[model samples]
Structures are given as C-alpha cells and as structure tokens.
Target: MSVSFPVSVRRLSAVAVAAASCVGAMALPASAAGPRHDAHRDQVAIGGVHSRSDRSLNGEWVEIRNNGRGDVNLSGWTLSDSQGHTYTFRRFWLDDRSTVRVHTGFGRDSSRDLYQNLRRAVWDERDTATLRDNRGRFIDATSWGYGRNDRSDDNRSHRNDRDDHHRDGGRRH
Candidate 1:
C-alpha cells in the first residue's frame, strides 16, 4: 500500500516531550558557534528549503551533520522552514562523530529511483537550519554565510569545497 499524503509527524496532533536526558540529547546551538564555527567539533546542522522540481521528482532533501562529540538519536525531532513550515520525524538514528544524510521524504515516499531522477534543490546553501528537540525546541540552527565562499544569504552553495561552508570564525567552536 502507498500513502497519499506526507508521512511527517506534523500530522500528529500532539507528542509528549520527555527530558533530553531520556533521549541523550541537548540543545544544539549554531548561534553560539556563530557565523564561522569549527569543523572538528561535533554538530548537527539543519539545512534549508529546496525548490519544487519540474521534473516531477523529489530530490528535495535536508542535511543533518553530527557535530558533537557523542552519538545522538534524531528520533522525536522535527524540522521547520524559515517560512514556518515544519517537517517532523520519528526514527532519526545517527552514529557518534559521524554524519547521516536523509531524504527529507524518507517514509513518506522516498525511493532511490525517485532521488536519482529528481534534481536536488538542496537546503544547503542560503537557508538557516533549525533543529529542534523532542518538544520541538531548537538544538542548533544556522545560516551559513560570510567568511565562507557563499557569504550572501541568497541560498547559493559552494560548488566543490566542504571548507566553503566551514569557517573557523577566527576562533574555536
């Protein structure tokens, strides 16, 4: 059977929020990291909005990086657009000090065939990514701009350099 609508937790009426310790997660702060943060430290950067695909495929995806020193469960979390639109999650399992890339449409209707066909309008370049806790609170959210290659808030991502988005802020994270 196939689902006709999005399978995001946004459809859920209400989900109880437990302690962060219960899930072994803390609030992620990109603001503290500032415009230029350290690449070595562990973090989970929530990316931005992708444009609708005319190809009628969905490669519109989100990026979640593990920028922390420990492993964290992405379960019971949600993502919100700068426009205030929200996408929720259920099982966001990640490894410690490792990064995981998820198709924002995962359970809703994510297929490799669909991803391969869809032109990725990634949330990477110009948008601010706000990651929330189980209660929908912010973990870490940032707008990757300035001191980096893109520098402008225009949603334009760097072509071939991960360092393009990574900055030292002339300080440490």
Candidate 2:
C-alpha cells in the first residue's frame, strides 16, 4: 500500500516543526527570552537598625545592601535622613548581593563601608531613610518605629527621651 499527502499538508508540517522549535527555545530555563531586567537591582534597603546610643560609632550605623544579581554603581547615590542629613555617594560601587555599612561617625570609605561623619546619630528610632539616585530621583525608603506617620500623636512627647536625641538641628545636606 502507498500513501500520499497534499502539498498543503507537507507545508503545514514544516511550519509546525519550525514553530515548535521556536517555542522550545523560549521555554528554556535561561534563554534570550529570559528576564531582561533585574527586579532586585534597584532593591536598596535600610537593612539593619542602629538607633541606639554608644561611645563607639560602630553602634550607630545603617547598612545599605545591593540585593540584586548585578553590581550597582552607587557613585552619586544619596542616603538622606528625615531631618535632611544626606550622605552622598562618591566612587562607590555596591557589588551584587553585597552590603555596605554607612557609619554615623567619621571613618574611611571602602568597598564595604562608608561614613556619614556626623557628630550625632543619623538613624533615628522614629524616622525615615530615603534613598535617591544621582539625579535626585526617588528610589527606595524605609521608615521604622514610631514617627510622624504613626497614629498616636499624643505619644510623640516621648520623642525627647529616645527618638529626638538624634536630631541635629534640622541640618541640610
């Protein structure tokens, strides 16, 4: 016995094979169709809290981490407190999945550390840390503890005890 098919059927089979190959390529785990953008690239965060008083500056540091797969060039990035005390980045490159500690006291800048050189504390127990790009574009912010955003304004009187101790007369960056 012999079997015969129309030209249209043959062309359709060829087209189907090509389409399947394309689909297979796309279904790959790591192909060109993979993620074009890093979702965690700009995911900068105020990681650890250092809102306490101590003689050493090490006890008063806020850490910023690059939680992405690619290294982030934070050359001109700025980390500003709610009181407008800003620490600008210079010649700093935060590597992928790494952290750089920003100390409140004077210190040297390194691949894993940066200093704010502030006589007083920078991170307040009731404050927000705003991170911005070089061009002043809003990137990320982390607010902690009781602050202006809290529901209880009456409890704000305690700001003098522990919260407001870090305010440096509303100095500008």
Candidate 3:
C-alpha cells in the first residue's frame, strides 16, 4: 500500500523545498555559482583604441588590470570578442596594481604581455570584448563605439575586412 497527500499539501511542500534551495544557494560563496568575477571584475577594465594601423595591428588590444593589493592568477581566464575571437590565459599572473596588455597579433608572451596570434584584427569601430573565468562564467565585458551611429573611422580600404565581420575569421582564431 502507498500513502498520498492532498493536492494542496503536495504543492505547499514543493514550494517550501524550492525556497530552501534558493536560500542555500544564496548562503554559499560566489565560487559556488561556478567561477565568478567578484572583485577582479571591477578592477579590470578595457579601454578604447587609440589608433588601428592597418599593418601593425597593435592598436587592437585588451587591457586587464589588477588594482587590488594582491596577485590575480588568470591561469584559465579567457578574453573574447563579439565575433567569437578568444584568447586563453596560461599560467598568467597579474601582480598587484599591475596591468597586462593582450594584443591581437602575433607576439611573444610574457608576464606583462600576451598575444592572440591572429592574422587579422579582432576589434573594429564598434565591438565588445568579454572576459570569462576558468569555468567560462562571465566576469566583465567592455564595448566601444557601439550604439553610436558615427562611421567617421571607417577606413573602407583594407581587404578581407568584410566590415570587421570576417576580420577574425568569424570565430576564435
């Protein structure tokens, strides 16, 4: 034989269980949410492109800073663009009050500099760069020239540009 509760009782029990679960989740640390930004999100921010020279591709970069008093291990963090271009960190550490420049083109990796090794550009007149933790949780996101109707910076001279659509091969390259 089996025992069953009234429909109202069963509904009440389900609601109680759900509320308890939510409370428990809230009590846990941010890491319990699976890799979060926390304080590092605010410390690190991206800036605008000073200039985008067609050859060097040096102007296209993302800058991450550690404004806190301790070091930040970016071992598995990732930086990605609106077009899906991503740069993964490998054993990289940002010292206290220090900054790292992630360039779009090929270069040597160091404590202060990293490279995306892409043949083309990753940023454009209007694009967003997102930073994610090791677990792929969003940490921070920065956008420039977006939501603006200005096209004054559109050179319209580079080949394979495709208006920044195909600049990064349309994926993480």
Candidate 4:
C-alpha cells in the first residue's frame, strides 16, 4: 500500500529512527564496543612518580605501567606535566605488567628508562602528570602535593579521591 505523508511527518519518523539507533548503541557496554575501549580504560596507568630531585635532572621521573596481559605499543603515547611539558614515546613497546620510567634529563634510551633530555627538572612538588594515548585520549594521571582547597585548570578533570592533592597547575616537547 502506497500512502502519501506530509514532509514534516516523514522527517519526524526519520529522526525518531536515528535517535533510537543512537540510543541502542549507547546502551551497549564499553566492553562490547571493543578492545580499543578497554585499552583506553584499564590497560595502562601512571604507576609512580619521583617529583623531587636534588642530585640531577634525571632524578625526577614518572613511571608508566602497563597493567594488561598483552604488550601495549606506546609508540605515539605522550606524558605531560601540569605545566604543559610533554614527552612523546618513540616507537616503544611496553610488555605486559611492565613499567617504564620517563626521566626528565638526558640519558641513553633503554628498555626500562627513557630520557626527556631537558636541562631543568619537569616535575614540581605539587603537580600532576597526565598520560595520553597517540590519539590524545586521556589514559591515566597521577597527582601529588595538592590540597582540597587548591585549584588548577590543567588537572581539574583528572581529580579523584586517590589523587585528590590539588593546586593551580600542557605540551612541551
């Protein structure tokens, strides 16, 4: 049966169908979305930090750990500080349950440590370290020395009970 409908009615029906499709997709759990989502959510984390260093620039470091069962390619991943100083990983593969320490000063790259080759220290007493994937998606963050009343634009979204330290606190290569 062929039935003619008003233009507005046809458009409404099309919109409704599109909305329903979007809702259905959204209802699906993140796991159903695929491994990519899982990788972004739980595979990697900022394991530790050595913010203060009196000996040398290399003394300051941030450790990134791969917590998943499979090797994670961190080739294009980035680690940044609250001051916007950033370090980009270069064709590196982090093995499962392994940790890589990114140092602030110059040093030869190795399986365990990578150097930023900077003259001055990067981490501060009260600062946040943010890690992002190759596509600039937030992966994990570690913050230290901040109080509840302190506020900062850089690490606001990353605030959590575990890393609640706050203070007003970036992409420097």
Candidate 5:
C-alpha cells in the first residue's frame, strides 16, 4: 500500500523533524546547563604547589591564581585534597591577575596568603588537589607525583613526577 502525504504536510513534517534535531543539538548536559556553569570557572586556576615541605608544615602550600580581569570572591569556595582534606574559604576576594598561596599550617589571612590552620600536612606526594566553587561545582584540579601506571614505589623514581593540570573539560585519572 502506497500512501502519499500532500506537499504542505510533507514540508511541515520535515520542518518539525529539523526543528527537533536543532533543539537536541543545542541542548547541554545537566551539569553544564545551570548557574554551576560559571563564566569565571576557567579564569581561576591552580598554579604551582610546593607539596614537599621538609622544614615547616607551613612551608607546604598550594597556589591559586585569578587570571581574569576582575576580582573573584572566594568566600564559600573549597580547596580539597585526594585524601578528602578540605579548606573552605572565608570572606575573601582574590584580586584580578593575582596569585595566592594557601599554606597548610596556621597563619593570619591576608590578600596574598591564606591558611588552612591544620596541624599536619594535607597534600601527599602522589595526590590530586581539586578546587570547587561555592556551589560545589568543580573548577580545576592538579595532580602530582606519579601517574596511574607508576603507582608502585619502584616506578616512582623512573617517572618525572611533574604537575599535571586538569582543566574544565578533563579530569585527573
């Protein structure tokens, strides 16, 4: 049996299909659709980290940078380690194009330095540091020490153990 639609009906059906396809193509993932998809997410980044501090606990620190043009308020943002140790920011603002060192030990908070006020070390030689926005949305992460294949102590010496930056579109394995 052959049933042919009128030309107008056929054109309307084709238009509907095209519209549906366009809508589907434009749709973003749930994680990337809301306020969590911050505009400044890429502007802030994790910089160099001196994870190995032999002398003082305060010597161990992670550096964060605001690479954008305007100031960013890091009041509720959190910086966490692979071991689940987290440091929440108080009422603080990071100036544009500035870097701040977040130390592991106690110290007075300043424009350039923030303290976690912990008694012990939080970052390990082979660990990942993750930064999340106030809404708990992932912003950036940095991994150091060893790669997945070089987990064993014997392989650690062979690997470069350099810092690996995992940006928004990627993750630390």
Candidate 6:
C-alpha cells in the first residue's frame, strides 16, 4: 500500500524527475502571487484549519482551505520538508465552501513515501512543512526560531486561517 526509497545524497535527480513528471503543471500564476508584505500594519489573528465529516486518515493527508476570494488551482503544488525534499500533489480546487485533502504516499522513491511522516507531515501538527505553489512560491512557511509562523499548527492560528478566516466580531461605536 505504501512504498519508500532511501534518498541518495550522490544523486537525487531521479526523485526530482519522478516528482515533476508525476505532478502535473498547474500552479498559481499572477493570481497565486498574493499581496505584498505589510511592514507597518498591525498583525491579525488567524485560526487553525478545519475538519470535514468525511475526515478519514487511513494514510498521510494534507488539508487545504481557501480563505481568499478567488479559487486556487493546486495542480503542481508541493509539500516539502525542511530538507527541501518534496511530495508533489495533484491539482485540486478549493471552492469557497470546499476543503480538499491530499493523500500522500507511493512514488518512484520509497523514501519519498509521505505516509511515513504521518502526524509529522500535517502542517497543523508537526509544524514541519513548507507549502509551495506550482511556480515554487511559498504559500506557507514555518520557523520554530524567533517564534516565526510559516507552518500551521493544529492549535496555532493565522490572520485568516479557516473558512471564516476574516470574521468581524462586530464593532462598538
């Protein structure tokens, strides 16, 4: 059901080729580019990811949520470790009310088998992942140092994390 191959330091090209070919070419172009950094703005509080009634984890899984107005195509999206070794996932659409889960595991390289990582791979749990777009742009990055937030923690949150990522708790005039 699951397979893995040890990565060779001498030659990782095979793995790279496998990943590229296996994962199609569909990434966020200008739309996926997102906005510029706000150096002067106050930080907003973000919430954790959501769970679906069909949430079944008989394998490794990554949950994606779209808090943005537009739809993002995750064809060539990649999930990488601190080492940069990545698992290329297929393109999936996350509608405004939709949440998608990617099951990882099985490829040319057995070492690349994502299921092996299990709990550690889930961004919200292990906090050990860097989500990249098809063009290789970092959608999410995490840092245990400086208390930075790139990885999504199961408990930790972002400015706009969940479906209601942007919620106004009502203002008092």
Give one clash count per candidate, in the order shown. Answer: 10, 0, 0, 4, 0, 12
lDDT of 1 by residue, 116-173 (tens): 2223344434455455656543455555433356544324442322242244321111
Mark the regions of model 6 whose C-alpha exceeds 4 Å error after superposition.
1-59, 105-127, 142-173
Instruction: Show the lowest summed lDDT stretch of 10 residues, model 5.
Output: 154-163
Model 4 C-alpha lDDT versus the unseen true structure: 0.77
lDDT, candidate 4, 1-173, per-residue tens: 99999999999999999999998888776547576655655888887788668888887888888888989889899988888888999999989989999999999999899999999888887878888888876677777677676443323323432223213222321
Candidate 5 C-alpha lDDT tens digits along 1-173: 99998999999999999999988777756546564346567788787677757788788888889988889888899988877889999999999999999999989989999999988998788877788878876777766676556443311323211233333344322
Error of model 6, residue 87, in angstroms: 2.0
TM-score of 2: 0.59
Candidate 1 wrong stretches, greater than 4 Å: 1-42, 47-57, 105-127, 144-173
- The prediction achieving the highest TM-score against the true structure is 4
Candidate 5 or 2, higher TM-score: 5
Candidate number that wins on lDDT, 2 or 4: 4
Every candidate's lDDT: 0.45, 0.66, 0.67, 0.77, 0.76, 0.41
TM-score to true structure, per model? 0.43, 0.59, 0.61, 0.66, 0.65, 0.39
What residue pairs clash in candidate 2, if any at all? none
User: For candidate 2, what is the lDDT?
Assistant: 0.66
Give lDDT tens digits, candidate 3, residues 71-138: 87889999876788778999888888888888888889888788888888778666666677687755
Between prediction 3 and prediction 6, the one with superior TM-score is 3
Q: Please name the candidate that would achieve the greatest lDDT relative to the true structure.
A: 4
TM-score of candidate 3 versus the correct structure, residues matched by position? 0.61
lDDT of 2 by residue, 128-166 (tens): 666666767555555567655544221222222222322
Clashes of 2: 0
What pairs collide in candidate 1? 28-139, 28-140, 42-67, 42-68, 43-66, 43-67, 43-68, 48-123, 126-155, 146-151
lDDT of 6: 0.41
lDDT, model 4, position 23:
88
